[model samples]
Target: MHLNYAHATRFNPPCPPSQYAGIGLGPRMKSAERFAGHRQDLARKVHEAGIKNPQVLQAIATVPRHSFVDAGLHARAYEDSALPIGHQQTISKPSVVARMIELLHKNKQPLGKVLEIGTGCGYQAAVLSLLAQEVYSIERVRALHDLARTKLRPFRIANLRLIYGDGIRGLPQAAPFDGIILAAAGLGVPDPLLDQLAIGGRLIAPVSKSETEQQLLLIERVSSHRYQRTALDEVFFVPLQS
Candidate 1:
């Protein structure tokens, strides 16, 4: 179920009248108007790609993408491309995000408490908050976590608890998560995370040599110490810093 971006690298333009709800003066037209426009494009792309969950697409549309990025990049928030969120980290592209969520939901039925490795700009966590019952997100960079918190302030996504620490260790206290999503690329799957997944739980990540081509892995915890795995298509991202 891995989708190689190398083949589907089409980029869409950003929203025409871009601005935040509380921060900016406002959308060019009404907030709903601009949101609808962006929602249509996002939904069309996601639906055509076979994302059946209507709730997922609705979440993509409702989330104010402009709020998740730097103000300078707000204009490109709706575009289907990755934008820098500082700390040498770039928020993953929209298409990739959709693809990951799609694969994450493929076989698993009950998506309960979730652990998110590499909180990044918190955009991914925000999306997870909508999909999962509870979300524990770990971010290596303190400043990045703080910035992401503020960006997601409006949503008051209470289900997401951000932790600034090494994501490689995962969240032990929140172990036995129903699902886990790792945002950064790593050389190998960290054992602590697998130790944390509930039996039959699924964890998704990109594994490969740092700074090189990485394969998306959808691993399921079949027992306390064992896992079943399937490799998806190629992806590239910043190396996970220890």
Candidate 2:
């Protein structure tokens, strides 16, 4: 069944001091404290908008978004807005991330191996690692790929792998993923990505419906050759490059 919904936009203020009491603080504790505080605030806002998946919400709270962006913008890390991550790409808004993942989770099965197109700064991949058993992320820009590798390494997210390549091509070696997500908007869903999804898998992305509008889309592979499409909230994302 095809479904479409208007985008619900909401933003909340930073978390209060009481919220950061128990988060550990050894070397990066100060930054960790800020992330904890802001992530809670972001999760609360995402939940208020109807994202009820506890795992998704917890992942949102646990991932340190500030680490994905430039240090100068760390102060705005938890503000529910996208931050530029160089190469003219931007980290996706926290709400959009939560919404897409929530929709994918509606598949009602464990997300085994997930494929992520556009691994900008590795923020989404980090979150996906928490939800799925393994995550394969592809980014086209070598600079961004290298940067994301460095940023994500310290986290020791062993289940996540970053690849520098053409994201539209998807990963054939890692085909049949249980879930696929794209960070950049494309004219339409790429066939390679569809072919890589397992029968019960779900792929979420932003597709350009017209020159002026792009809509969030969910594609679920029901059978070998049968798939269902659902159009969701209006969204803005960097265009996918070849």
Candidate 3:
């Protein structure tokens, strides 16, 4: 079913899949064959990187990473590195994606409705689709937002909603999310996002301590006004923008 949540009117829905056909994806490079081999290899690498969740591994393996990257760079799609998707942003590395999603799934109960900030090429949202009942992704850059909408439409992901807006503002109209993930790094977790979390919800993002250093931060809302924060591995990401 299509998600007509409270924030549905904030942005236009993605176009129908039919309109996305034949968009030039550059030279075809045997993506299906390469994806099959690379997906399995990436899954194995992610497992070794401490993401033990079987479902997370499967999602990583099932989604085509090459489909989310530039056709010219499809050859490196399976590599454990982030690739630029224009606009100074990069699709996060496979290991980071798997670990973050695995952390979200580790919450006390399964995730129902999840919010993802920075849709990028929509790869993370697609991965989240496999885990959450519904996924709401917001992107601040209109170009990237429009690109993601087109690139993702063919997938026909019904439970996913892509919105063009400031990621730091958070989507309060659809507040009380089961989990929230931020793809960009910020000095601190945005208060608006913390306020939007459900009582027992979890939020994951990269937190910057200085201009050059960052750490993967996970915050859990235990009570209405109380949150516990934990620092995970060091990581790098573009700064979160308003």
Candidate 4:
């Protein structure tokens, strides 16, 4: 299910206006301020769930989860639960997302470039943008791809690039990523993704243990010919698809 270069379409959102451009006052600002407390509370919950990285917790508190979901689901946005994002996909729970990202940050080194295999609603990509210097996210579902693009555009994340393609193939042209995170569960880590990891890089994903069970898996490239794999946390995620 690997897609060639022609099948992948890159979609980079327009840059946002400057923060100091006198755009902070208004109804939007007030609404965002209103959600600030909720975001903070969500971060605290994620922290309690065992995500020890302070930067990851800060990112959890900074990204407005409410904005990534529909207006009707806003009430539950900050809760540590997954929400439907159409196309039979659900946004990963806040605690799960935090945990995975924290695992990627296990080495305590700033990420250079990261790849995200699922961009449902672009929520995780937004959080990745805050941690990674560059982020390339691939989504196989065309509708979800467009949905994520639309939802993410308003935020104007400059470092994030959305692509509509087969994530199982991994982005070869952009190989040697410092970190890779997959939002879906599969039988195992795709070989292409493993090959794309740079030496000293880390990848976090969920591997299916059974039809109804999954466990978080971490792979770290220790050398050109060596990789270390570890299994952690029981979890559930939508199946990874090409």
Backbone clashes, each candidate? 2, 0, 0, 0
Candidate 1: clashing pairs of residues:
2-233, 176-196
lDDT of each: 0.69, 0.78, 0.81, 0.82
Ranking by lDDT: 4, 3, 2, 1
lDDT of 3 by residue, 28-131 (tens): 33446556778889999889888888988888987788888888998899888999999999999999999899888874333677889999998998888777
Best by TM-score: 4
Instruction: Provide the clash count, candidate 1.
Output: 2
Q: What local lDDT score does residue 187 receive in model 2, on the 0 to 100 scale? A: 94
Q: Write the per-residue lDDT of candidate 2 for residues 123-224, one digit (tens) a residue.
A: 888787777766788888989888887777665555566777888998877688889999988899889999999998899999988778999999999999
Best-performing candidate as measured by lDDT: 4
Candidate order by TM-score, highest to lowest? 4, 3, 2, 1
Error of 4 at 130 (Å): 0.5
**Which residue segments of model 2 deviate by more than 4 Å?**
1-31, 107-110
Error of 2 at 20 (Å): 25
The parts of candidate 4 lying over 4 Å away from their true place are 1-30, 107-109
If both were scored by TM-score, which would come out higher, candidate 2 or candidate 3? Answer: 3
State which candidate, 1 or 4, has the greater TM-score: 4
What value of lDDT does candidate 2 attain over all alpha carbons?
A: 0.78
**Tens-digit lDDT track for model 4 on 1-242?**
11111236443332222221111232245577788899999999998998889889988998889878999999999999999988899998999999999999865645678999998888998787777777789899989888887776665556667888899999888788999999999999999999999999999999999998999999999998899999999999999987
The deviation in Å at residue 38 for candidate 3 is: 1.8
